[model samples]
Target chain A: MINKTINQKAWFMVLPVLALVAFNAIIPLMTVVNYSVQETFGDNLFFWEGLKWFEEVMRSERFHDALGRQLLFTLLILLIEVPLGVGIALTMPRQGIGVTICLVLMALPLLIPWNVVGAMWNIFALPDIGLLGKMLNGVGFDYNFTQNTFWAWATVVAMDVWHWTSLVVLLCYAGLRSIPDAYYQASKIDGATSWQVFRYIQLPKMKRVLTIALLLRLMDSFMIYTEPFVLTGGGPGNSTTFLSIDLVKVALGQFDLGPAAAMSIIYFLVVLLLCWVLYTLMMRNETN
Target chain B: MSSITLKSLRHSYLQNPQSEEDYALRKIDLTWRDGGAFALLGPSGCGKTTLLNLISGLLKPSEGQILFDDSDVTSLPPDQRNIAQVFQFPVVYDTMTVYDNLAFPLRNRKLPEAELDERVQRVAKMLSMQNQLKHRASGLTAADKQKISLGRGLVRSDVNVMMFDEPLTVIDPHLKWELRSQLMRLHQQVGFTMIYVTHDQTEALTFADEVVVMYEGQIVQIGTPEELFLKPRHTFVGHFIGSPGMNILPCDWNDGGAVFAGHQISLNGNLSNPASTSKLQLGIRPEFIRLASEGIPARIQRVDDVGRYRIIKAEVGGTSLNIYANEEVEIPSDSLHLDFDPDHTHVYCDGWIHEAKGQS
Candidate 1:
């Protein structure tokens, strides 16, 4: 058995964090749980309506649409980001001053706040004064993101790719850098073509880091609120109203407390289930 | 089927080499005979691995040409050179089975399944890895993984040459000997041209038919193990090749013999290049230094009891020297006399050994 006294000291160090987590997370979670089961009115009257709100949410089309949007956005984000990021990373230099310059440029996009990213892209795609919009028009293209549903969706997806592909690039670059020079030497000696080297060596070696990037991108894309909220306002007949935006709309916009609280709980469970599945699959592959 | 030759090879990390000081590999000219087991041996940063990389076509030389069987291949990439290399660390496809790992190159070349299986099984049996064929490479020990790497390199029989860059570094000490012997056996069976690079003297000496000793980006000497030990062409080679290394003592040369710290030792033969000497020194192996009743007086410092033999370290005229003797020999407590075997001793001048006059 491990020495209990050594571990006892660790609890002392972790106590403050535990208390902070309990105050910030557990307390709010308990409140959500209480609200999930109880119905309330303006006079603070509570009526026990256990599982009724949950049943109603389970049958709601709005909940289904939001969940579907969230899943599709996450899938789209992963499909675009991973390949684009890996390509950019592979094209970057292995060493010298060029590598440092490339790393700093890639990191610049990530340092900008998410809300600012949304605002910046919103202005940049305005179709009249914005540089990208003017350029697109100059090329004799009809582009009005705010008015067109397809254009609005394209703008959001493109903006997300610009903001998040950098993250994947940085992670993969680090993974690539950590590979020993000896492996490259071995590959060279084996007469491996460029594609063979990338397929058999680089891909397998980048597995763990790719899994991490995939999980982070999936979770963030699923829960994304600020960018789409600010960029499109879920406009053009809810073309981009993701789950988080819809949840907020119900909780604060419509103020239907019981249904919104129930939806929030279900939202949390969906994210948890997806994250658990992703983690399990990644860990199983790593172990084998 | 091919012999590799380096013609006036020179390299430097700096773009322009202003002088002799700027080169990493100075104008080296050498050749490896076809189907020869050759080794480039030296201490760390002595340009042994650099020369190996140049031969393997991983590094392009700043000057000179590399020819394979008289075909100029200096500018070719490693893939175009048709050579197999095993690195210092094990580099195997971790997700593939041992059999698949060995068969990857053959499969890439579009060989038939029957031929691939035959070659893989043959190489695996040579490496004593036949039983691990079905198991994934990820679960094996480091040595076993290294064996798979070796098998991968050896399985392709059509390659012009095979190069090993310190391949046994990760192996356990006890297992190194067995692996070295197995490599020798494999070479004998296959008769492929091989160039082994290492810093370990024992591995180089025991494994290679021709050992090229390198120092400071230059080939100091290239010979068999016996020639390297018995006739080191440079002082660095003298200091590098032996166990505990050869003893080098500064001496003044006269007409008949050399004098060290006022003690005159008679010469076994006349000096070859007697008139051309500037600075001279005496070089002798510790194995040739005998502890005797009367000779050069020495102060005994320490004795190390290695299993089969004892190493006696002593100071003679303020210069430290080591003597290896049988464990049965009892050392005297206070002081001892050292005698140099004249036939085994060499006279070095200006960092090069001098042959007796009229002998060359």
Candidate 2:
């Protein structure tokens, strides 16, 4: 049996982090819960309206549209990012100074702040001064992202792919590096074609990291707010108004705190539900 | 099964090798018989693995030809070579069931489902892995995982050769012996041309019918285990093939005998045209060094108990020689006399030994 010691000193080491987390997260969470089930007209006059805001949020068509848009965006991200990231990682060098250079370059976009990514892409996609827009216009093509709904949606998706595909690449690259060289040698001797090698060895070996990349990208894209907001400002008549933007418009812009708080809770639950389903599925697959 | 012939094979890692000095493997000429179990035995960095990689087609020799059954396949890739390799570490699909991992290669070829199942079951049963067929490979222990890797390689009988590169290095000690014996049985049942590479003497001696000892980027000797043990062609082979290794003492050749540290020992035969300038040494295995009453005087330094035998490390005329005796024998505390068996002793010049013309 292991000797058990209860010094309580390690708890002191974590006290500062606990205090910061309480201030940043727990207190605001309590306030949201308080506003979720109560009605406040003014001067903190609270009246009980149990389940009323939840019922309103459940029936809201705007909430449904936003949720649909979030799900579609996340699905598209997964469909594109996972395969493209693995492909790029496979083609990368296994060693030498080139590996270090490629790793550093792949990690640059992930290190940039989210809002800065938004602002940078905003300037770069403008129809007149933007490089891509001007180049397309120079070739006699109609490419105004801010005016057309289809173009706006395409621009947002493409921007997201450019911004976050590097994250998947870095993760997959780490996974690829962790595989022993012996596996490749074994595959070579197994008379495996290049496609067979990728399908059987590389892909199966990358399952764990791919799952993590999938979940992270799913959550991040579902909660996406900055890039599309900065690029089109949810213009072209709600074509790109994702759930986060719609939630913000309701809660802070329109000051419907009770219903917004209820919507926020519902949104949190949706994300949590999806995450739990994915986790359980992956864990079950692993166990079997 | 098919024979492999390597002709003037040379390999170099550098694009432009400076002169003939930068080659990792230099001008190797070897031919392996059909269904022969050959071992490339060498210390680390001795180009044994490089030669195996060339045979497996993972590497193309920089200068020469690799032929399988008289067909030139020097330019072929590994997939085109039709070979199976078990690596130093276990390589199995961790997410797949152990049975599925064994069945993967057969299924890849689109073999009939029944035959694939039969082959997987047969190989798993041979490896004693049938009981764990339904377990996910990730949850199994390392030895079981290695068995799965070996089974994956052995499941396909149509492959021309099966190459193993230090496949048992990671297994537990007791399990290593069991795995090596199982490998021998597998070889006997399925006569695939096998080339196993390892640095361990016991693994090489027990598993291979023909052991090719390599040193300094070249094969020094290729013979059976008994031949290598009885007559090692090179000093490195003599030093590498035995347990405590062959005891070597520097000697000066005189008339019909050599003087080793002021003690003149008569040789078995006369040397004709002996090396005039190079340094010479006398080599003998510990088992051949006889401990008796009338020979060169020696003092016992240390005794090591090796279960069934005891190793007597003693000094005779300022030269250290080890003698292997039965564990039940007792050493006298006073002076001791030692004599080497004339037929078993070897005379070395430079690094190669001068073999007697008519010796077996």
Candidate 3:
């Protein structure tokens, strides 16, 4: 019953953003696509080799190992950081001067640059010096991340948890603060225990923010390169060389542009698929 | 159901209150009989919610004691006090179904499943939500959510007092009447001591047997709805309760009673304390004033025809006053005068009404 006017001029308003996206994303992506489907040896000359690089990247053992490591690393950090961040957020004060102090402290880690975070952890987890490393060593633990595979994985995981758990904490803290005082007052009047209040009230209210925190952490941890690279540089016989590190090694380290381009597309697809699945699964129960 | 007695209950949000001005709730001494429906009526920031919170044990009083049928519950938390409160906005557990939301309080008490189910079912039926028991609480409309909140309170049998802090605020206009009547029927059926807090005079007067009018963190008056309508002890109640409110005219007190402008207005009786050195004013409701052929000289300024009646704005000696008349009453083009019914007119000293001799 309602008539909607169709105006073609609306496209003119979107032209600027469309052009910016083309320049920044679409054009660069086309170049990668061009390399992905062809063979390049030297000079500016390229030969048609359709699907050959894709097949090679898919069958490579190095690519599989890097992907497996990346998956494990992402899973481990998520499992550790989410619960830990929520716990820390729960303990943070809801009011007074303490709230500001706790918020500033939680935000300190997220404000640092990714490379700086990696570099700081690299020196901070060294066996001979650094507060954490020296204390662990003084407590009779052989903790040299530079040479040992187990210690290297431990240091990288710990460093990632330290550098990024604050993001989840800050998000969840905002979610907690958004809940009105009436909910708590009502729960108390309902004779609910502390655990029940957290389960029925706090947890349900924080679902949206927690989903955002998880998705952000999942994608960021999957594509992680700067922190682990600066800290360990995929050292100790490729134990910590994730997909991004392996891709860089192929594209820039060994100059295999075709396979690298193909692998980068696969990496991007994997991240996209994971994020899609996560978003769908988490949002399944929200009907409205 | 139990009687709730708040003995000299005072509250202050400040850690160290220096004076009476720092207190959010001043000295409040009140007692509600068992199974009584009471409404705390006030404007916003008038400490109505503070008083409700103090009684519900959501906030501790700065001083004084609270007794529920003779047992002191001042130190008890809300859970131990066995009091239930519905907030201004509905507070239903989003993840819980209607049945589960009603059963939450009983479950927290570790009641057996059989009794809990029975109680939840009874309350659900009372709220007319029996068919929606399986539906998620969050999916319901605002009115239904508020019903679930009230149902949660009603499910617990041992609740000493059920408090409502403007629970119908978010409800739709048509739904507010339905929910209010439903609450009245529920109160009759359950017989729980209920305290409803609101700034709305209609909600307060129609819902409660006794309405406690609060102003500036103090209980101004507590009386039946009829008593408040007929007689207001304080000028604030006279102004706050009625639509268009009572007209207060600055006057001088003399032996004839109260003198308004140059005319001596006859009051109900003589002021008990005539020697009190306080400023005097005459208080009379608009409905009690009539246009008479021979009375105080007045000029008709404006006439507003409401649905059932007409409000005539008149001026007596440069002071504005409102007079209500029947819609059929003929308006005089000129020589209009006003008459105040002696029985309904009272003299006010300062802000408090000076009770006439032989009148309670």
Candidate 4:
């Protein structure tokens, strides 16, 4: 055999990253994995639950209802925010002092704490004295979020859109600015109408950024709990009790750790699966 | 086909221009004849792009009337002016295929589908890009994208004028010659009025029938390549148009000859100095200076071999001068005498050529 020299020491460079992941993500995940397979009754006493908790959570109607509500909220907000964000970005002034002003104002909502956002909306939609409530009542509509299921759902959806749409706007605005002036000039010379320019030039250029915005909004909306928990507290007959709020109720409130852990794994897998499918579909046209 | 005229064209990027120096294009009045090939040759920051944009209707001139076939079109936009322009970097739609890119102009005009397809195929074949028309433009090389931009300009038969603003700046070195010759062949075949703007002398001299040389926001000279090489109308043209540019030397003038460094050089005609505050000097190309048996004595300084010719740097008076020696010529170590061609030499006053009284 021909002589060959090989060094196995390069594998050491990955040990540090492996250690960090073990502490930060893998170890915690394995703890949940352990708790998911067994039942704990008291100190130093355990029983093998096997697949019992998974079966129970899958058969529960509460889980199904919460999952349904979560899906509807995610779909509705995405439908509203992505297009509304892009429209606002299009109308925003391209440069000068106006750009700075609009960007700062758009960013104001995203910077507030989630609970604070929920609390602020809680007061702002109060039936008696809240500005929105008073305006709606003044316009002859019955609009009390605390007492009606439909109003609770609407208020929660509205709150998420107001809080998250600016993230999409900033991303889209950055994408629009990177396009060179030559594209517009060339299209002008080619006699393209404004609609044609937007359809061909602007939309195609914005596809990548828009994909990222969509994925981020989808994942965050799926895991949303703090804002709705603070505002509606999963109330008005459980109309807005999304998956996270339901998970917290079963885990901490009802003391059902095994079922909660099983549900958590299922929820994480759903988000991961959906994001992978959506990203693959959106990036289908790119050559690479 | 239509001739274009720019009348009293002036432009300033400033909101309020107070003086002539504030204008980017300072009062240019010129014409491009129908069915002519012209090049705007200038260095950077010379308002060449500004003038091209004005003609293409990208920028309205602050003060001028832009005329196409004697119609006033100063206020019109680029589409209304029927102008087509290719930028320095190729501006192709990345999402479109090469076929669709070529068909863009015609499609925008709502041409019949059959006619549009025919025109796109014709231009693609002319540019030798017919086979690659099915490929995406973003996936192609820079040269291929630029060919598509050129094809887009050629696809429209109704364009009043076609302009190129340094279109080959991004092309590979070997590909530049091929693209230039392709453009030349297209010009000869189509006979469309073309305006090419470039800072490189070779591209300008090879591409155009007439070269418009510019300097500092104003056009300094317009002539054939031969005329620009032999007799430059402006000192900047003489310095800018040739390899190793023209050499200029200061001298003391007498009635019939000039003296520099204790040598008397005879003049071919009666020439005198101008009385303006501008300096006057003798301008001669490096090719016209020769080493002879008896002439102005000078100390040979250094020699540089440039393959075909040896450039001899010699010091005569207080100035350094460059002279081209034939490759086969032997070097004289310490002593050298240089001769000037009196017929080709001219005096420049204030950066412009002063005509010799005896010649045109």
Q: Which candidate is the best by DockQ?
A: 3
Cα-based lDDT at residue B207, candidate 2: 86
Clashing pairs in 3: none
Candidate that would win on lDDT: 3
Candidate 1 DockQ vs. native = 0.63
- Model 4 DockQ reads 0.73
Per-residue error for A122 in candidate 4, Å, reads: 2.1
Docking quality (DockQ) for each candidate: 0.63, 0.49, 0.89, 0.73
lDDT string for model 4 (B1-360, tens) is 689899999999998999999999998989989989999999999999999999988888899899999899899988988888888988888888899999988988899999999998899889998899898888999888888877888998887888999999999999999889998999999988999999999999999999999999999998999989888988899999888888888866655566666677766767765654667777888889899888987788899999999999888877888888999888799779889998778777778887766766
Docking class of 1: medium
For A44-107, candidate 3 gives per-residue lDDT tens digits of 8899999999999999999999999999999999999999999999999999999999989988
DockQ-based ranking, best first? Answer: 3, 4, 1, 2
Better of 1 and 4 by lDDT: 4
Superpose all Cα atoms of candidate 1 onto the true structure and report the RMSD in Å to 1 decimal: 2.4
> Tens-digit lDDT track for model 3 on B266-331?
776566655558978788999999888889989888988898998889898999998898978998
In terms of TM-score, which candidate is stronger, 2 or 3?
A: 3
